[model samples]
Target: MADVAESERRILVAVDEGEESMHALSWCLKNVVSQNSKDTLILLYAKPPRAVYTALDGTGRREDPSGYLFSSDILAAMEKYGAEVAVCVIEKAKKMCKDLQQDVKVEVRVENGDPRDVICQMAEQLGADVLVMGSHGYGLIKRAFLGSVSNHCAQNVKCPVLIVKKPKTNAFNK
Candidate 1:
């Protein structure tokens, strides 16, 4: 039992619907995570919170027939979209592992919250040995305005965080 525990490694990778995130996952599969039965790869996707709709007027009076800001149909569509994104990310990660010929166990987790908070909390809860993510490679001013998820994860996660910066190639640039 102790030997099995010793051999097992939990690697958490943050994935999103972006090329940079996929590149990071591919890099982790090929370089960081080992192809072993005891090793597990966890792909985490943080779905943004559902948009809040308000029907209040200037005097805070209800202005819409429905009390809720968003219609039920809109909420349902948003939920479906989030689910689809999660499914796609999981499938892509699995395919990357298969393409690399790595037989590591894979798990998918989809949570709704701030990406930075969710990622940090998940990494700690999972006792991940390493947390892998990709940098958007935003410039200083852009990052300052938009904020950087990779930067936040690195500072807050308990485990070592690997931020993979995608290299620029002719094919990628075009």
Candidate 2:
């Protein structure tokens, strides 16, 4: 019975908006697929709250309180990229599973708040058996800054954690 159950385990993958995450998600879908065990792919995106602001207009006129968040272009860009990225992850995971002949459920989620905190909370709430993710890969110049997601999960998560540390590609590649 233990052996029977072992083969039917489910995997929960947390994907960030980066190449490494895409790579990790791709790898899992291709190699870990199984007819017995179901894989659950969860894509995580940042949804930080908008910043409020007050401004004055011309002719000594005061404008009503409002917020731009950051900038019109940035907000638009973020919205576009966030939607595109999440869809890409879902499509990639689905394509991989289809090709691999596995039965898996992929869940793509976009949420607000700190990435680290949100990921940890999501992992627990979903009762993920294992968390598959990539180590901090993009930006932050490994020598200077590090992403908090990997570190926080390693320290706080009770389930097993898989960290993909593929070598750095180009200076900007993750």
Candidate 3:
């Protein structure tokens, strides 16, 4: 068991290229994480596996005639796009922290896998005190069909999970 005094408080926030996730990050920064050296904020992004596409040759053959089996360019482009999204999210999180005047340590991690699996695994591996994420606020049928990453992470992770749901209000409500 790790000593209480020596263990730093690790708060892991799962982020993506979505407004909901960004809202969760902002909420975590404002509420959960403290501005102290003993607290660390980890922003995690999971890139889903790319789909494999096949190109036909001039003779209508399924495989390429140039001896190249697959399109490396397509794969590279997908990876590049994922990297850019990850960088953008991380930078935004950093800026949010700066705006909040939080001096806590911030770390960014990007991995290729399912978001549900990646978030839970990272929370456990980092010994996080709490895992924060955004709720898409899907309805029963939609959530049943599409499934929920936050629900899966909440169920699977060892630490407590915080799901930030976006507030629904009309202009007149405020």
Candidate 4:
């Protein structure tokens, strides 16, 4: 939350461990730089699929990792960069704007569930005015293989959705 006063404008952003997320967050800061309204920025992470969760133990048994639940991996990753990454968004905002404490609120929400469903539900629950997300910059093949969560979020969420796709990298040159 910045010092901008868009009382009706709340942003919910989804991150998938990519720099694109940082870009989106930066965009939000730019938009709400002087905002003085009460606003929230939710940093949400959908739970990985059963297969991804199972790969840890290599047991082939598919178990739900529990959406919105904090796990060791999540905490460990947050611990990196001296826990600065976890606090980066709000900390940066606080540093930039002296009114954050008096006017705006920022929260980090880590949820576990189908990303598509979780994003929409969380936005609805929070009464979000806009949903922000990284595009993952997938090509036809990668989108086809993994399914596009941003695309799904755009289609399903009632509010306007901003899908921020990073410039294509060599990772998807099929």
What's the TM-score of every candidate structure?
Answer: 0.84, 0.65, 0.82, 0.62
Each candidate: RMSD:
4.1, 5.8, 4.8, 8.4
**Candidate 3, which segments miss by more than 4 Å at Cα?**
1-7, 54-70, 171-174
Over the stretch 96-164, how does candidate 3's per-residue lDDT look in tens digits? 877884577888888888898889888988888999999999999999999999999988998999999
54-137 per-residue lDDT for model 2 (tens digits): 232223333533332355676677678767765776666566556664557656677767777777887887787777787655
**lDDT for each candidate structure:** 0.84, 0.64, 0.82, 0.66
Q: Give the least accurate 10-residue stretch of model 3, judged by summed lDDT.
A: 55-64
What is the number of backbone collisions in each predicted candidate, taken in the order shown? 0, 0, 0, 12
Cα lDDT tens digits, model 1, 1-174, are 556545878989999889999999989887876545477889899988766665432345445344435567877898898889788877887788778845778888888898999999999998998999999999999999999999998988878999999997797678
Tens digit of per-residue lDDT, candidate 4, span 1-174: 332354456678776556777666666666643455566666676654343332344443348433444477765665464334435644454443344334545666756568788899999998888898877787899999999888888888999998866666575675
Model 4 bad stretches (over 4 Å):
1-6, 32-34, 49-104, 168-174
Clashes of 2: 0
Number of the top-ranking candidate, with TM-score as the measure: 1
- Which pairs of residues have clashing backbones in candidate 3? none
Show model 2 residue runs off by greater than 4 Å.
1-8, 46-81, 137-146, 168-174
**Clashing residue pairs in candidate 2, if any?**
none
